[model samples]
Target: WHWPTAWCHMFLAPLFAATGLLLRLLLRLLLDLHALFFLPHREAEGFKEQGNAFYIKKDYEEAFNYYTKAIDMCPKNASYYGNRAATLMMLYRYREALEDAQQSVRLDNSFMKGHLREGKCHLSLGNAMAARRCFQKVLELEPDNGQAQQELKNAEAILEYERMAEIGFEKRDFRMVSFPFLRCVMRPLTAASFRQISAPLSGFLLSSPRSDILRMDSTNADALYVRGLCLYYEDCIDKAVQFFVQALRMAPDHDKARLACRNAKALKAKKEEGNKAFKEGSYEAAYELYSEALTIDPNNIKTNAKLYCNRATVGSKLKKLDQAIEDCSKAIKLDETYIKAYLRRAQCYMDTEQYEEAVRDYEKVYQTEKTKEHKHLLKNAQLELKKSKRKDYYKVLGVDKNATEEEIKKAYRKRALLHHPDRHSSATPEVQKEEEKKFKEVGEAFSVLSDPKKKSRYDSGQDLEDDGMNMGDFDANNIFKAFFGGPGGFSFEASGPGNFFFQFG
Candidate 1:
């Protein structure tokens, strides 16, 4: 064992070196295990906190970098992916944010913030339907989430606006289609005070879900303009004008604010002129002025609705019955509760002898107003409609309603003789048929009018005793025979009218 001391020294030195290398490898593996099991978790948590701090400071790029680092350290952590997604959204990388959000939800389907971020991305990218589903999913996870409720309302309002606009386009109704986006964009912020007006304007305020940009930076021109829109739609025209002017001052190139301001001013001026003209009884001038006002801003739904109604009134005065009806209908479409429009349309329908349409409009007016005048109009329309349905027996017989019995018999006899079918038997079939029809009408008129009971009933607007009565009930031949003495007693010359003398058959 102790042979050759130099060889023993060489072997011992090599064995010690190998043992040292093995010990070093074991220590390195232990360090790697520590970094894997403990250090990464701590580092990832620290990175996530840093990312949140940058996010709170609104430093989106730095936030994005930190969140990405956290994700790199903890790739399967749903919260890291969600945080990264939110930072990506703040950076305006919606597509990338959407991917991260989706991944976060896939990693942990119950992550409400991940779903919220995904919904936000979808909304920003104009996928309202998809955004709605995401918000709905969030609500399913946390039913009382106020943010998700508001966002869900926003998506639903957008979809409803689109549906209404499509219906208006299909019906060729401009009132229903105009201002839909404006209304839809205003929904979530003013749902209680202004129930009828809503909007889906997700980015109009240019703010993230966590904080309002306008609150942070009041000089944002676009935000100011959107506020102006809200005021303008709420009928606060002066305040809206002020905001619009402020926006224009902040951003000199703000074309929409300038146009809105101009339109608001012009609308007020033209509407006032229209009112002046109407008060002065200058209906033609009023109609022109109101029409001009309507063309100024189609997005001003309330003002345009009023303008349409005013124009309808002027149209009524100018005897433009059809145009008046159309204008009133437009006003009603713009504002379904517009009682004045219904009244105007009813009057136009009355003038046009459209009693059924008049009745419908008057009924709506009466239902909404419940006023004595509206009720009277509704009743009058119903009466006129009832009378219109019945044949004017006196008119058909060429006699006045007050014609005496003798006068009625005389008129009927003359009309019957003139339109007798046999007298025109040699004429064309069409002419013969027409003569026969008139002959039957004359006889029926006599049958109804010559009888005192029937005449009284007819004059009183009561239905005849026989509801199924027709020309057959009148028996023109029998009436002719009875009037001329007997069935075979009288005949007429068929050749010409002047040679018609009764002869015994």
Candidate 2:
């Protein structure tokens, strides 16, 4: 805050330039010392010194040409081969680097740097076992080498990480974090250069399943702890820590989980406080606390749903139905079977006069649980569904509600010809089923409009004219069976297993 923003940027830029320049100079000086000490074939050594200078100057092509000249003059120098291998690796010519490294080791088996170079080449080629043996051999020669130890550890970790990464890839369709999946190390992460001659593959990666990393059940301490461990193994440390902390806070006596919890930054205190504010009707305060909790562990499905649903409830109280429905939908996506999401969405649908959508929502709830209350609510929904379906008979026939009998008759005949089952003999079974229903609807529309008494009743929403004097002895059940031919003719089981084609309109 003390320094101006413009000044801070200006200050950092030049400092970075100076630091880079200093590094380059230091490297050039070191390479010069190596060339001076290497006294075999003065002309060849001079050429290698030029190569080393060019290498430090970031001109790999020039360095490679000079190194090639040095190798031609003095084919017996292990250091020249090793230096060339290092340059080839920088240029991403890994197989060429491996050949140089092999020559270097062949020239001088005792040369530790030559072996190290070969090990790096093997590692780059994804030859982990070969790389391991090279590192092990270095250890046999020099038992106390720290770089060798760290390199060995990293090679093992690479193997483990790759195995785990593959497992994750198989389980889902996703790339990985860019760091090469940290920033690509000095030694590239991949075993070899990746190439493709086909079309350019390009697309945005979809959002990952964040909910899998989190836990929302405050009472289930053991469950939360177990879930955290699962996430930790999957390399999601940040989310894992959140669950672990919550689990430990709830079950303090759970010694093993508590130990793991100690390793994590906890979210239990804020969440509990948020829950308290919610119950006490301090919604704004609750919102603030939950917001902070979400910042720490946004992926916790249950926790996130609770936050969304709670906010939605407040929005609902304020008559902000649209906002409430949006939040509820978000919660549902996170946890598909979230009962509260279904209930809230159903209420929104009802408020908006989307009776068919409400019926569908209620059907989902009924499938999940069939409590007495749900049964009562479902019956009410069923009634509403029938009324809604039959509410627009005039519209189905493409006639106004106030249209005369002649107009109604003309509209019905037109729609009948367009949607008749025989006209759509080559249509899909589902389409045919819909057409048959529409034909029945059109006939009913004509029946209502033809008679003043029934038309008055239909317009008032006082009747659903399933049966009327349209066609003589027109069996509705026969029409239903013609499409869905089964033992139960037109069985209106809303949630039946064999009800795939049932639109329930």
Most lDDT-accurate candidate: 1
lDDT of 2 by residue, 112-188 (tens): 87778788788776676687888887788888988888777666666654554444445552233211222122233
TM-score per prediction, in order, is 0.47, 0.31
Candidate 2 least-lDDT 10 residues: 193-202
What would you estimate as the lDDT of candidate 1? 0.79
User: C-alpha displacement of 324 in model 1, angstroms?
Assistant: 2.4
lDDT at position 174, candidate 1: 39
lDDT of each: 0.79, 0.66
Candidate 2 stretches with Cα past 4 Å from truth are 1-266, 388-505
- Candidate 2's TM-score reads 0.31
